[model samples]
Target: MLHRCNEQLQQFSHVNKKALDQYVNFTEQREELQKRQAELDAGDEKIKELISVLDQRKDESIERTFKGVARHFREVFSELVQGGHGHLVMMKKKDGEPADDDDEDGPREADMEGRVEKYIGVSFTGQGETQSMKQLSGGQKTVVALTLIFAIQRCDPAPFYLFDEIDAALDPQYRTAVGNMIRRLADTSNTQFITTTFRPELVKVADQIYGVTHKNRVSRVNVVSRDDALDFIEHDQSYNAE
Candidate 1:
């Protein structure tokens, strides 16, 4: 009888232990579901906030784009009216930055004045050497003209460069220097150049040459090969011999 009672008590204890384990597991699963639902709600709120912020940003961006385009068109219109005679206009900075000044008009005026002075190498003071485009000699004026042209070209480079009698006023040495400079610029930028000249020395460095002349009141242009040019020079020398 005692052994039977002990076996029954052990079986009862085992069933109670299994039921307690099932209760604990059910409680844990319910807690985990609640935690997941709370997390999902938080995520939804965060996504809504982000969407609101993005909408605001999109509106701001569209406004900024339209303003930028309008400003660009205004600048283009101004340039067209000015006959494209000015240097490349860049934004002005006060104290080396855009925002260091309280006055709005100060920076623009300063930048325009600075650019004009720099382009002409002028001084605010009366003591400095004054050089004007009209007062310069032909060669000096050519140099100044070329300098201005180069400055403008640096701002906006073109596909082809045509130099018509640019070296007409230059001496032989200056002509060679200008030729070398052009060659260097062409080499670096891969720009095609067509220059008209009557000087053989200037034509010597050209890759291709076209001679333009008026014959019988008609203009004729002939593309002369390097060999033909040499032959022509030799034939002219022979004629000088006679």
Candidate 2:
């Protein structure tokens, strides 16, 4: 009985040692988990900060681009319409309506910062008219559209441009201005303009010209000289007059 009791006591001691080791291992794991949690929290905070800064920079870039394009639009419109004025408007909205900051439920500060960029819009006023684009005549709309295109191109120029019947709806005065502007751009900038027009204004300023002839079901395109292009324009004008 004495030997049996000693063996039982030894077994109990071994069990107690194992339990102690397990407790230590659990404690270490808890500490490691807590450290990792802290690191993850810090990383999350850093990511949020970076995102905030990126948003700010993006807003600033947008504001700058809008302002620049607006200024260019104003100048181009004046030139195209001859005494016309134009500008861009920032339409900040709250729930799809115009924002009013005085309201208690107005947009937050962050929303305001981004709203200008997100809701930037254009307001066009044609020659001797104090109306919006929707109220402008078809000819006026064409001129305004062209002005806007040129304004945007000034902000971000391309290597080449293709315009199809851009002067079709334009008045003679506006067409002349557009042709002059295209010539000026071609002379000053290292860009090419490919335009199709039945008016003599564009043909007169063109470096190269092409003529398209369609007979029955067959169509043919051929390069033509400046005088030939002008003759074609004259013939088209006469046909339209009849």
Candidate 3:
């Protein structure tokens, strides 16, 4: 009986020791998990802060670019059309987003703030009259559009530009101004201009001239002298008039 009692006590002592070791190990693991969770929480906050700073920089860059483009547009317009004024206006969306069936009461203020889409409205003043883009004459509209393009180019110039009949709708004076502008740009910058124009204003300023002739529905492009190109354009104009 004494031996059996000694065996029972030993078994109980072993079980209790095993349980105590397990409890200590579980406590250590819990503490480690808590430490990892804290680190993760801190990292998450840092990431959020970085994201916020990036968003702010994005907005600032957009605002600066828009202003630069607008200023260039005005200057280019004035250059193209003497005694004229032009400006660009930024228009916010009224409803924040496009219409959807799921949105019954339109977008909320927070939704509107999140939207980045915007419209540019052009205001042009020429010949003592201010007009919206929709109200301008076709020729006037063409000038305004080209002015805007030139303005953007001033902000961010490309290596080259290809314009087809850019002055086709312009008056003779406007065409002369535009041609001079192109000439000055070419002389001052590394950018190249490849334009197809029927007017002599542009042809006279050409560094090289090419004549395209269509015969029997086959077109041929060949390098020609500046004089030859001008003569061809004049002949074509006369033919069209006839």
lDDT of all the models against the reference? 0.56, 0.77, 0.77
Residues 162-213, candidate 1, lDDT per residue (tens digit)?
8898888877666676676667667887777778764455577787777666
Q: How should the candidates be ordered by TM-score, best one leading?
A: 2, 3, 1
lDDT of 2 at 217: 89
Q: Candidate 3 — which residues are off by over 4 angstroms? A: 1-41, 93-132, 216-218
Clashing pairs in 2: none
Error of 1 at 83 (Å): 34
TM-score of each: 0.43, 0.74, 0.69
Error of 1 at 25 (Å): 82
Candidate 2 lands at a TM-score of 0.74
Q: Is candidate 1 or candidate 3 better by lDDT?
A: 3
List runs of model 2 lying over 4 Å from the truth: 1-27, 94-117, 125-132, 215-219
Q: Write the per-residue lDDT of candidate 3 for residues 134-185, one digit (tens) a residue.
A: 8878898889889888888898999999999998988989989999999999
